[model samples]
Target: MTVALAISGLQKTYANGFRALKGIDLEVRQGDFFALLGPNGAGKSTVIRILCSLTAKTAGSVRIFGADIDRNFPLAKSFIGVAPQEFNASLFETPMQVVLNQAGYYGIRRPVAAARAEEDFARLGLWDKRNEQCRTLSGGMKRRLMIARALVHRPRILILDEPTAGLDVELRRLMWRFMTDINRRGTTLILTTHYLEEAESLCRSIAIIHRGELVVNTATRELLGRVDLETLVLELAAPLDQLPPSRFRLRRVDATTLEVDVRRETLLNAVFAELEQSAIRVIGMRNKTSRLESLFMGLVQGNEDSTRAAAAALSAAAGD
Candidate 1:
C-alpha cells in the first residue's frame, strides 16, 4: 500500500517556548482508517496543524502522498482536507455558501463547486438546511456542515479532529457510517477523538501521543491485546451479606452489585460457574470499560510516570 501521509523527526515549539511536539515520526497508509489520539496539551493537534499547513513546524519533514510540505506545500495540501475541532464557518453565511467558498479556495469553479456542494449536502443530510444560516443549525448539524465543507474539494485524505463531538448518539453513528463509506471507497481517513470506542471500532491502526512524543503505534487489535485483565460489572439479583470466594478477583460495589476482574486466560463461563456455585445470581452484566480505553490509560500513565522519574533524576543530578 502507498503511504498517504508521513512525518519524520517532527518538532514544534511555540513563541512562548512551549515544546508542543518532540521529534515524533508517524505514517498512515493510503486508504487506511487511522487514529491519532492523545490527551489535552499533547502534540496530536500540532501534528494535524503541521500537516494541514496551518502552522509551521520547528524542524522535521512532512509529506502528503510523497509531496513534501516544505518544498511543495500546495501539492501536499491539494491532497488533504481537514475538519477541525472547532466550528469555523461564517455565522451569517448559509451552509451552501460556506461549503462553496471552501471549494473556491482550492480554485474550484463556481459551477463545479455548486454541484459538489449539493452532493455533499445531500450526503451529510443537510440538503434541506443548506440555504439556512450556519448559526441557525444545531450543533450536530454544524458538525456535519464542516465535514461537508471539507469534502467539497474531494481531497483524497480527510483529517477529522473530534468530528463527532457534541453529537447525539444517532447523529454520531450516522456520521460514522458516512466516514466509513468514504474510507471504503478508497479515501484515507485520519481521526482524533476522545471516544475510545469510536477509535477502537472505526480505525484499523492507532498511534498514541503523550507529552509531545509518539508513545505507541500499532494495529488496533494488537494494542488491545495488551490488556490482560478485564473488569465486569455485574448486577446481582439479590443483596449480599458478604462476598463469595472465587479464583477471579471480586469486589463488592454495593449491596447488589459486584465488580469482577477476569484475566484474559479465564473463560467467562468460569465466572458464571463460580457465581452459580455461590448462589449469586447476576441479573445483568457489562464490561467496566472498553479494552482499548484500559490500554490507552495504562500507556499514557506509564509514560507520565517515566517522564516524572527522569525529571526527578535530572534534578537530583543538578543538586549533586
Candidate 2:
C-alpha cells in the first residue's frame, strides 16, 4: 500500500527549551482511517502542525504521499486539507465565503469551488446556514462548517484535530458518518481527538504519543487484543449487604452493583455460573470502559514501557 503520510526521526523544541516532540516516527497508508492519539501536551498537535506546515520541525523528515515537505512543500501541502482543533474561519465571513476562500487558497476555480461548496454544505447539513455569518452560527455549526471547508478543495488526505469537540452525541455521530463515508470513498483520514471512543470506532489503525515519545502504533483491533483484562460492570437484581465469593477479581461498586475483572482466559459463562452459585443475580451488564479506552488510559498513565515493546513487536511482525 502507498503511504499517505510519513514521519521519521521527527523532533521539535520550542524556543523556551521545551522539547515538544522526540524522535517521532509514524506512517499512515493510503485510504486509511488512522488515529494519532495522546493526552494533552503529548505532541499530538505538534505532529499535526508539522505535517500541515503550520510549524517547523527541529529535525527530521516529513512526506505527504511521497512528496517530501522540504523538497516540494507545495505539492506535499496541496494533498492535505486540515480542520484544525480551533475554529479558524473568519467570523465576519459567511460560511459560503469561508469555504470558497479556502478553495481559492488551493487555486481551485471559483465555479468549481462553488459547486464543491454546495455539495459539501449539503452533506454536512450546513446548506441552509451557508449564507449566515460564521460568528452567528452555533458551535456545532461552526465545527461542521470547518469540515465542509476542509472538503471543498478535495484534498487526498484530511487531517481532523478534535473535529467533534463540543458536538452533542447526535451531531458527533452525524459527523462520524460523514467522515466514515469520506474514508470509504478513498480519502485518507488522520484524526486526533480526546474522545477515545471516536478513534476506537472510526480508525483502522492507531498511533499513540506520550510526553513527546512515540509509544504505541498498531492496528486498533490488535491494540485492543493486547489488553489482558476487562472490567465487567454488573447491576444486581437484588441489593446485598455482603459480597459473594468468586475466583474472579470482584469489587463492589455499591449494594446493587459489582465490578469484576475478567481475564482473557476467562469466559463469561464461567463468571455467570460462579455468580449463580453465589446467588447473585445480574439484572444488567456492560463493559466498564471500551477496550481501547482502557488500554489508552494505561498507556498514558506512565505504563507505556510494556506497550512500547508491544508496538515494536507488532511493527516487526508486519515487516514494517
Candidate 3:
C-alpha cells in the first residue's frame, strides 16, 4: 500500500529555545488508523499542526499523498483535514452553517457544501440540531459538530486531536464507531488521544513521542509484544493470610485475587502446582495482555533510567 503521510527529520523549535520536536520520522500507510500517543507537551500536537499547515516547522519535510506540504501547500493541504484539540467553530452559527462555512474554505461551492453538510450532520446524529446555534448544543453535540465540519471537505486524510475529549462514554463509543466507519471507507486517520484503550482498539500502528523526541514507532501488536511478560489473574478459594514461596513471584491484587507476572518459559501448570501445594484452590484464572499503558510507561521510564546510568558511568570513569 502507498504511504498516505510521510514525515522525515521533522524538527520544530520555539522562539524561547524550546525544541518542541527533535527530528521525528513517521510513515502512515493509506487506509490505516494511526494513533500517536504521548503525555502533554510531548510534541504530538506540534506534529499535527505542522501536517495541517497551522504551524511552521524549523526543519525537515512533510509529504501528504506525495505532495510536499511546503512546496505544494495547496495540493497537499487539499488531501488533509484537521479537527483540532479545541473546538473553533463560531458559537453563533448553526451546525449546518458551521460545516458549510468550513467546506467553503476548502473551495467547495455553497450549494454542494450545504447538501454535504446536511448529509454529514444527519449521519453523525446532529441533523436535528442543524439549525440550532452551536452555543446551544451540549458538549457531546459540539464534538459531533466538529467532526462533521472536518468531513465536509471529504479529504483523503483526517487528523483528529483528542476528538472525544470531555465526551460521555456513550458519545465516545459512538465517535469510535464513526471513526471506524470512515477508516473502513479508505480514509487514512491520524489520532492523538489520552485514552490508551482507544488507541489499542482503533489503531493498527502507534508512535509514541516524549519530551520532544521520538521514542517508539511500530505496529501496535509488535509494541505490546515487546514487554515479554504475561499477567495471570488467579482467584483463590479463600483469602490468603500470606503468599506462598513459589517459583514465580506473585502480587496480591486483593484478598482473593493474585496477579503474577510470569515469563514466557514459565507454564501455567507450574503456577497451578505452586498453588496446589499451598492448598489454595483456584476458582478461576485469566491472562491479561500487556496494554499500551504499560508499554508506554516502560519506554519513557526506561529512557530516564538509561540516562541516569550513563551519567553515573561517566562519574565513575572520571574518579579513576
Candidate 4:
C-alpha cells in the first residue's frame, strides 16, 4: 500500500523546556481516513503544524507520500492541505475573496482559481454567503470557510485539526458527510478532534497520543477489542429488595435496574440464565461505555505512569 504520510521519532520541545512530542512513530496509508487523537497539550497540533511547515520540529523525520519534508519541503508541502484548529482568516475579507486569495497563493491563475473557489464554496454551502464578509458569517459558516480554503488547493492529503469544534450537531453531521465523500475519492484524511464519537464513526484506523507519547495505534475495531470486560446495565422487570447472593456479581443500580460486568467470552445468554434462576426478569440491557470510549480511557489512563517516566529519557536525549 502507498503511504500517504510517515513520521519517525518525531518530537517537539518548547522554549520553556516542555516536551510536546516524544519519539512519535506513525504512518497513514494512502486513501485512508485516519485519526490522530489526544487530550490538550498532547502535541496533536504541534504535529500538524510541523507537517504544514507552520511549526518547527525539534527532532524527527517526516515524509509526505515519500518526499522527505526537510529535503523536499516545497514538493512535500504541495501535496498537503491543512485546516488548523484556530481561525486565521481576515475578518474584512468576504468568503469568496478569502478562498480566491488562498488559491492565488498556490499560483493558480484567476480563471482557474475562481472556478475552483466556486466549486468549493458551492459544495460547502457557502455559495449564498460568498459576498458576505467572513466576520458576518455564523460560527458554523466560518468553520466551513476554513475547510473550503484548505480544499481549494486540491492536495492529496488533508489534515483537519478539530474541524468541528463549535459546530452544532446538524452542521457537524454535514461536514462529516462531506469529508467522508472526499476520503472515498482518494483524498487521504488525518483528523484531530475532541469528538471521540465522531472519530469512532469515521476513522478506520487511529493513533492516540498522551502526554507527548504515542499510547495506542491500531485498527479502530482492534482498539475497542482491547478491553475484555463490558459493563452492561440491565433493566429488570421487577424491583428487588436485595441482589440474590450468587456466583454472578450484580450491582443494584436502581429499583428496576441491575449492573453486571460481562467478560467477552461470556455469553449474554449465560447472564440471562443466571437472572432467570433468581426470578429476576430482564427487560432491557445496554453497555455502560461505548466500545471506543472504554478503550480510549483505558489506554490513555493506563499509560499515565509510563508517560511521566519518559521525561527523564526525553531530557537526556534532547541534544540529539
Best by lDDT: 2
Candidate 1, residue 55: the lDDT equals 87
Model 4, residue pairs in steric clash = none
Q: Which is better, 1 or 4, measured by lDDT?
A: 1
- Give me the runs in candidate 2 sitting further than 4 Å from their true place: 238-245, 250-257, 290-295, 298-320
* Candidate 1: segments with Cα more than 4 A from true spot: 242-245, 253-255, 295-320
Estimate TM-scores for all models.
0.85, 0.87, 0.86, 0.89
Reference-based TM-score, model 1? 0.85
List runs of model 4 lying over 4 Å from the truth. Answer: 245-247, 290-320
Question: How well does candidate 4 match the true structure in TM-score terms?
Answer: 0.89
lDDT of 3: 0.82
Per-model C-alpha RMSD:
5.7, 3.4, 5.5, 5.2
**Model 3, 86-158: lDDT tens per residue?**
7788999999888887887888999989988888887788989999988999878887887888888899999
Query: Model 4: how far is 270 from its true place, Å?
Result: 2.3
- Output the lDDT of residue 139, model 4: 81
Summarize candidate 2's per-residue lDDT along 92-191 as a digit string, tens digits: 9999999888888888999999999999989999989999999999989888887888888799999998888788889998989999999999999989
| Tens digits of per-residue lDDT for model 1, 3-59 | 999999999999899999999989999999999877666777788888887888999
Name the 10 consecutive residues with the lowest summed lDDT in model 2.
310-319
Pull out the clashing pairs in model 2: none
True-vs-predicted CA distance for residue 25, candidate 1, Å: 1.4
lDDT accuracy of residue 204 in candidate 1: 93
